[model samples]
Target: MVMLFESSTIKNITIKNRVMMAPMCMFSVEKEDGIVTPFHLTHYESRALGQVGLIMVEATSVTADGRISPLDLGIWSDEQIEGLHTLTSRIHAHGSTAAIQLGHAGRKAKTNQPAYAPSAVAFSEDEAIPTEMNEEKVTETIDAFKAAALRAKESGFDIIEIHGAHGYLINQFLSPLANTRTDRYGGTREGRYQFLRETITAIQSVFEGPLFVRISAEEYHKDGNTMDDFIYFAKEMKKQGVDLIDVSTGGLVQAPIDVFPGYQVPHAETIKKAAQIKTSAVGLITSGRQAEEILKNQRADFICVGRALLNDPYWPKRAAEELGYVIEAPKPYARGWA
Candidate 1:
């Protein structure tokens, strides 16, 4: 166990370190067409060169209706694949593995126009209420995921992470509180798990690399989903060839969370224990010691930092130095190390 410093493998891919840069939306893309502009390339390349082991690209929607923002990257068609390929190639040149986060906004879809969801519910005070998804739309959504995985492979990504966390369409379906359908998609726990299970199986057909699913370990509502749901989902996902469970919490409804240092680590612990699968702990993880403890305790397989890396893109190199690794500063910065 002390050899936790050793490299880790998931399927065909290997992460040099367990440190990953969490996917966070920059909402910086000026185009509504979801093109990978200079801003996207620069932002990701900076982290790769700065020494992050693996950087999951910000949530890229599988369809226009799946996007969190109009400017978010989309893989709905063949045209979008080239731009992502460019970005992935750039990350590889910098010696970091590139991962694409595929998502669907679901009920969270639409901001200005007609929104959609598993049920007619408003997620936030300002957001519009969304329409429930019919069976036809659900089948299309699964195909969209499969297509997105294909695009991720075309773009040369080392891994593809399905965005099932944060009250997105997939998570909305996972939670009985949000998913009220009586058809094949809702009702019993297995029924609620169907969407994710099918989505994973569909995507697996296209992506042979390491597959990841970011899930809300706890929906944070008495009536909503819980850790047990995610644990069950994790085991099923593993059986379906999912490589890791990116552990996260809440986002079913817009409510303030009582956050503290390493607040969601326990969520990862519970899921890891129950599912006995590789898990990635995210949210409020800051220091090296805290990250190290998570690894040592078998609480998580990966420690993902989003805003923390944004604040200091060089944090990985600094973290390595602090954690007793011989970190090599950039050639330009090496003189300062003297």
Candidate 2:
């Protein structure tokens, strides 16, 4: 049976193990220029040195106004390439493949700049109603995703994960609750998914490496997208050359979601079985035994360790020991681990 320590490969890239670092926003850019800082280099390298299989960088903006916050990283311009390239080189040097989550926060964007969305709606009462995106604007955003993909390739990322989850721009378009447009980009499920399809097509044009899409499978609202809806999306993503579906939930609306260990694992398992695509289970997955069971049961191809990894960069190394798997630690750390 596949275990957490066993390596997994997607397309041409091989991951050292099943422990993937989920993309979490850092909001650490001191200059607000969207360029990565030395903090990012150190933060990611620590995970790589800790033996995480794949280190996915935080949600990086594809456009100036697409950032979730002014402090988020940006890839809309070529100037940011140097920092990202440096990051990828460090990750590779330490035996981990680097990946990045390209995203546009859309109406959820908290920057001072005006936000854009499929519909002219506000994420909440305090937030401003965003300008509805016309065809021209939509095309511009898609082009941005394409440009960002090329930048990711140039930066040497082994995988490009489209951040379509967490109530971001793509999720805003996908969720009926946030999108009430009557145009071609809304109304029906296919219409709601059109933006993502176009974005994927655009990215695939330049990126030949493994592609992944993270989606909020359960919107937590009665009228929002459901498991079946996500399965359909997973199938569509497969047709669009998506190598994996990063399964996450409950970012479409501000509803209370009960938290528990492995709450989102079933969503990943369901999508993997129905959509016939590889998947990564995320959320509250904190231990090696839990991750191993999920893989052994064929629920997911990878286990995304989020907050646990943040809390302890060496979480994976500790997990390996707990599972009785002797994962090779870095030479200097080997004596301490021994």
State the TM-score for model 2.
0.98
Regions more than 4 Å wrong, model 1: 1-5, 111-113, 330-338
For residues 1-338, what per-residue lDDT tens digits would candidate 1 score against the true structure? 22224578777787767789999987776768888999999999989878787989999989887788887888888888889999998889767889989988977765455666777767877877788888888898899899889888988999989898899988888888788889888888889889988988898887788988998877767887666667778888878878788988888887679999888889888888888888888888876777888899888989999778989987776666667765566676687653
Residue 74 C-alpha lDDT in model 1: 82
Q: For residues 257-320, what per-residue lDDT tens digits would candidate 2 score against the true structure?
A: 9999999999999999999999999989999899999999999999999999999999997898
Best by TM-score: 2
| lDDT value, candidate 2, whole model | 0.93
Candidate 2 regions with alpha-carbon error over 4 angstroms: none
After TM-score superposition, the amount by which residue 267's alpha carbon in candidate 1 deviates from its true location, in angstroms, is 0.8
What's model 2's lDDT at 245?
95
Question: Pairs clashing in candidate 1?
Answer: 107-116, 107-117
